[model samples]
Target: MPISSTRSSASRIPLLDILKGLACALIVGHHLVFYGPMSDVAYPLAPDLMDWLFAYGRMAVQVFLVLGGYLAASTLAPQGVARFDSPLQQVLRRFVRLSTPYLAALMFNLLAAELARYGMDDGSVPAEPSLPQLLAHVFLLQDLLGFEALSAGVWYVAIDFQLFVLAVAVLSLARFLSVRWKAPWLAPVLVLLGACASLFYFNLMPELDTWGVYFAGAYGMGMLAFWAGHSTRPYRWLVALATLGLATLALDFRGRIAVALVTALALGVLQASGGARHWSPMPALQRLGQMSYSVFLVHFPVCLLVNALFNQFWPTQPWANAAGMVIALALSLRAGQWLYQHVETRLVSMPMALRMQGGLLVATGLVLLGLKAL
Candidate 1:
């Protein structure tokens, strides 16, 4: 079944937006204060009060991952009036919707980096990325090959993109399996597979980093929620299971188990909130959700620029760092609004075909590659 692009007519839940907004702000706060204080240039302690703040701050990224997966699945999965298209079409639509904003952001960040480099007098030449790496960024293939990260916060985008692909695959497989086998147990099996995968990645592949496995579980959980969202029955067992999962998270169980817990929590939230149909009225919260993506993308650069300026001019006062972060966040939020309104808004809704977007991506990659050779 094909999911419709047309948004549901239910009154949009402002709380979702608020959650997104706060989540984005948390990410900015994490990058600005948490990582900074941990680095040698900032804080010396790792697990003390400062360290604890950073640790908790980092969880904001995790929140975004969980929320994003939930939202993506909610929007993309087959639903009312959503025409069922081939898997290829599903994949293409995802690509187009995701990649366009990414491309715009990448270009903007690169240009900003270039400007920063030009203004610095430290005699440190910024290392120019290889053309291949640049192309990879444009194509959202950097993570697939373990290449360089593109934007400051783009690693999540890469994860999201990959999971989106997997979602399509999983949905198709689930549909096929349901037809051939028992239909009632398909969701449970998927939930089980996700649990297994999370454990395998968390325990066995500790070197793979928390971002990948964490987001994958979140995305899978989102898919689960999507499938169950339309159900009319009370899912008492599901609620109990999700509660157990969240307990694992609160207990500091990292990796697959933890990811599962977070995913479950997200599903629980959506369920409690009425599955996007009857979420409580929280206009401010809704605004946050709407700006969450912008917050995610814009914060890193803002912080980086602020740090650079601080390093160049003002002596490192903790007060200055605090002020810089506050200022950067305000500017970033304001800029995000403008960009979202003028650029992303227009581009997202344009009668743009995925094929053309693909071609432009290829051309952009080639151009970057040629620049590397120069």
Candidate 2:
């Protein structure tokens, strides 16, 4: 099968974009309350609202996991069998695409943290990065290595990359088997079984949470959803996917898993019924969706800056703290736009080898500077 011909060139799915935008906004709000001192000031005014946002808002990441799986399947194996040349090359390409902007954002975050340090002492201020810690983060192993994260939500980046590589491997295995067995449904069945194991077994183990396997259930659901949506027997596959997801949740009830299942089902139905077209024409939300990754990368530092400033200037003013949250949100969006254009777009266009060299150069420079400062 010719690669491009089997690939799905489905029009940009507006529904998915909308969901991404909404999830990004929730994540930003979650960080603002979870990280900043400003939330302390605003909490008394709206305790219930603040508590909810602080507690459950981070679950928005489930949305991204589902979407990532959907998009990965759509690109790599639209018919549920990998057609790419080399999984290693695919992994390298994805690493570059994710890490280039990630490194650039870390630099900005370090600068912001330094500047914020001069303003106030609060939990929001991350400790100064050591040379080793910086290196760990550069390799996206800070969490696994037990180093404190330089920025909030960075764990997701590492996990996202891991999930992509794992998915590619599974798809590649299916492709290999397809050469021997000419059954068109063999690949999808194998992938679904893997997903079931993830959901019912791996996901139940909290110790595996740092690894992609813990979250593979949800990510795999997204992959299954994508294939199911596009299948010739769309209704049959969609029903099967939903039933499996629900059964897994019933076996081991997790609120987050429930949320993931719902998100996956919604995305599957939207794609199946062509509801991914212009159902809701919110341009701003669509733009947010486009920049969601950038927003995720940079929002923590932006929130830190605002929190430091608010504590310094209006420590007792509750309303000022509320205003600062709004300012932080706006600035995060603006910063995301700047980062996407100057950092993400440029690096994504470069060859993988060049991008890796550039990232290493930047990381080495930052680490050396941090060591010197210490």
Candidate 3:
């Protein structure tokens, strides 16, 4: 049976925005506790809470991976077949969308780190970046190349890109086969089987965690949920997808997989019931979700700055540290709003943007090299 296409709409989904807002908050809290000395001071007061946030807050990223797949499917190939003229072009477009804001954030963080260094000594300050390291980051290969990250959570940016490219490639290949053999089911079936293989086999191997295949299981679950929610027999497809996901988990239990499965299922149910479209309007949550990517990109530097200020001024007051955390969160949101407005929403031609990014990368690398020599 052919999967149904999602109804086209310009309005953003409230449920999705709410979820993204929540995820961004969790990630911000996680970093607040994990990266800075503020957490150390507060740990004596709320040790258990601090520990929990430090440990599990990072898992919130699974929500993003799942949501990304769902939205990618909704936008790129709603009927479970590639619609673009070239998958490469689609990938390039996504790369530009992600990279522009990312490069701006990186430069901002670099400046923040330098300023923080003059204020006090702290672990939150990243080491001065080398030319090679900057180049690796420009290409989104820092983690894979074993170079130290200049900022927290930047690895996810690279991983997001990888997962997107992989998804497009898989769907594009399936589309090619379907066209060649004149079998519509062939595309969906092949894609589904590939997802299963990812869940059962590739996800089981930890060594591949840096690559998209490692997270393809979770990402694929999102893709499947999108199709299932829009399918003619929505319940049947949802149950089938859930059963497959559960079976994979049963074979090799993973905490992350459990989280991903639940997230995907929740998204599927929401989409199927029209709940995604009809949720009570929340302007605050909607705004947060709209700027979630910008928030994710810029929050770390804001946190780092707050941590430095707190350490230099208060040093030992728990209340001061707590207050700093609140201030950091507020500033992060404001910064995100500004970034989204100025950098993310601004229109630039793809070729021009790519060229600008490439030029900036070379200039930054040269400056880093000159600094190393000095």
Per-model RMSD to reference:
5.6, 3.0, 2.5
Instruction: Give the alpha carbon lDDT tens digit for every residue of 272-293 in model 2.
Output: 6765565878889988988899
Which candidate model has the greater TM-score, 1 or 2? 2
Ranking by TM-score: 3, 2, 1
Ranked by lDDT, the better of candidates 1 and 3 is 3
lDDT of 1 by residue, 216-328 (tens): 65555555444444344325545645764565456556654564455455554565455555555776656656866765666555555655676666544656555655677
- What digit string (tens of lDDT, one per residue) describes model 3 on residues 308-347? 8889999999988988888999999999999999889877
Q: What TM-score, over all chains together, does every model reach?
A: 0.76, 0.92, 0.93
RMSD of 3: 2.5
* Candidate 2 backbone collisions, by pair: none
Show the lowest summed lDDT stretch of 10 residues, model 3. Answer: 4-13
Per-candidate local distance difference test? 0.57, 0.84, 0.84
Error of 3 at 119 (Å): 2.7
lDDT score of residue 191 within candidate 3: 59
